[model samples]
Structure formats: C-alpha cells, structure tokens
Target: MQGHGYAPPPPKRPSTGALVVLRVIFVAVPILSIGFLAWVAPLRAAIVTHRRADWWIFGGSLVVLGISFAYLSTDHTDDFSSPNGNVGMIILLLNAAACVGHYLYADIRHYHRLYPMVYLPPQAPAANYVYPQPPSPYAATHPQTPVTPPAPAPHTPAPHTPVPPPPQRPAPARIDQVRAELDELSDYLRKRDGHYDGGRDGR
Candidate 1:
C-alpha cells in the first residue's frame, strides 16, 4: 500500500545560504512598516514550517484588503492628493507586493515543483489493500505428490545352533580316606626302623 505514494518526507531545508537570506528578509520586512511586520512575519513563519497558518493568513489578508478597498473606494480622489498620503499608500502597496512575492519564493524553494499536493494533501484514511500477484503456471497444473518413504527392509532370522554345556570334573576324596592313607604310611616307617635295630644288635 505504501509503495504507491512513497514520496520522501520533505528535504531538510533552510540551507545555510537560504536561511541567511530568509533572516535578512525577515529583518527587512519589519523595518518596512509596522503593519507589514505584523502580517508578513507569521505568513513567512508558517510557510517555512509548511503548516496551515500560512493559508489562513494569506486568505485573511486578502479579505481584509478587499474590505479596506471597498471602504476607500468612496473617497479615493480626495485621499490621493493629500500630502504624505500618496507616499504612505505607495509604501503600503510595495510592502504587500514584497510580502506576496517572498512567500511565493519560499514555496518554490521548500516544496516540490511537480505536485503541489505533495507538501500538504487533504486528510483521508489511507488505502489498506494490496494488488495480488499472479499465480505460477507450474503450480496450477502439476500439483505436488506426497513422497512415499521406502518400505522397511525385510527382517531375516539368522540360523540358530544350540551351544553345549562344558563337562563336569570328578568330586574331591573324603576326609576319612585321607586320614587312613597317612596312618598306613606311619606304620610302614615304624616297621622299617624296628627291622634295622634288630640287625644291628645281631652284629
């Protein structure tokens, strides 16, 4: 939506040189006349700020000028020849021209040339919808298919062989059997000792 009228915010203006000139003109406008100072200062200020006051002042000034003209139209000849009156009127005309011309210059300097509406447009609710993009040709006709995962590989049982148990060792001899063998060995040794003693005595 914003892409339609993406005009940049007005440039940061009142450049150094332009500001110097405005300052000079602003100072000079006051010196021209008290009436002009009262009117022009606000107009110039509003124009530089790009606000609604400039329009109001410009309209108000024209209305006042028209009313003053109608009042003065009845006695213009008498007023024209009066001493210093002509001079004062001349000064007033010049001041008005100067004010209008300076405000115009401000408008041209600070705003874009192509579009007056660029600076200030009538308020309205902004557009909310965007244009739709065209659909892709391939997606319309082809329609994507869901991918099937590969079937789980078949489970094959490995050939099984029973493992045999190890052979058992014989049980240990009883304690009574071991005692009897020791007694037999002691008796043989006693008999041999006795036999040797008998032989020695005979000698």
Candidate 2:
C-alpha cells in the first residue's frame, strides 16, 4: 500500500553559482528577469510546491509587466512632456514596480526560503530524545471480549455391521402400458353395459 506519511523528495535547489547569476541578472536587467527568468525559477517553486498563491503572485506580476510593456510600445513613447508620454511614463513606473515586486517575491522570499529548506542536510535526532510514536488510527475504542474457541466436537463410533440399502420404490408404468390397461378396462366396462364397440380395436 502507498504510504500517506511518506513525502517524496523536495525539488532540487539552484546551485550557488546559478543563484548568484540569477540575482545578478535580476538586479542588472530587471525587465529580462521579470519577463523570462521569473517563469524559469520563481514560478517553478509554485509549481513544485503546489502553492496556488505563489502561482498567482508570480504569474500576475509577469502578466502586468508584459501588458505594460506592450501598452508603452504602441504610440506611448517615453516623452514625459506630452499627455501620451505622461500616461506612458506612468505605465513604465508601474511596470518597474511590478518588476521590483516580482524580484522581492521570487528571489528574496521564495529562493532563499525554499533553497535552505530543501537543500539543508537532515538534522540528527538528539541522543536523549525519545521519538513519540503516533497512536494507531485503527486502535479499538472499547475493550474487546476474549473470544473462546469452541469445545472439540464429540466423536461418534462407526457402525460395525453393514447397513442394508433402503427399499427401492417400483417406478410407475410407462405411458403405452398405462394407455393399454385403461383401454382394456374401458372396453370391459362398455361391453358389460352393452356399449362395447370393436371398430377401435380393429376387430
């Protein structure tokens, strides 16, 4: 049977060099990290850990970054003097905010938190500590009555003499014999009463 208590191994943590590279990329090119690396690293934790909130937070940040980028590109240039420019600038600022949020959440919160938890060696049990055994879920609630085995059945002595077979009942007469007898009786009765007809008898 599959065990409910057993947990599969945690997802592998990123290496020191890889983690360093990731942090550098996130700091140097926040947009690149927000757009792509976010999916690669931060979002992966949400998937591996089956954390729905992380999925939404990381995924939503990426989406916001994407939408703002696309919006700013189409006739929304970075010219703060004009009206479209102001709106575009606001979008860029929002996008930057989203990128920062993503970096903090993914790199700082999840990366640091998840790595140590997953990669750290298991701690040895203390010498004096006694592990408490969990109570069995299948334990009986009430004291059970002791079950007594039934007494050995008494033995019967076999008969010394050969037993005779049961009397066989004679089988009833066959249909043809029964019909012949009925016809004879009928003819005798009919002749006695002066009603006998020999035509049926081929006489």
Top TM-score prediction, candidate number = 2
Candidate 2 Cα outliers beyond 4 Å, as residue runs = 1-12, 31-50, 62-80, 115-203
C-alpha lDDT values of all predictions: 0.62, 0.62
- Taking all chains together, each candidate's TM-score versus the true structure is 0.28, 0.36
Would you give me the overall lDDT of model 2?
0.62
lDDT of 1 by residue, 1-203 (tens): 55677777965544558866766676566556543453565477576656676667666665554544544454447655643445545555655655555565656555544234446667765586576889899988998899999999999999898889898754466666777899999999999999999999999
* Clash count of each predicted structure: 0, 0
* Error of model 1, residue 117, in angstroms: 30
The superposed Cα distance between candidate 1 and the true structure at residue 98, in angstroms, equals 14
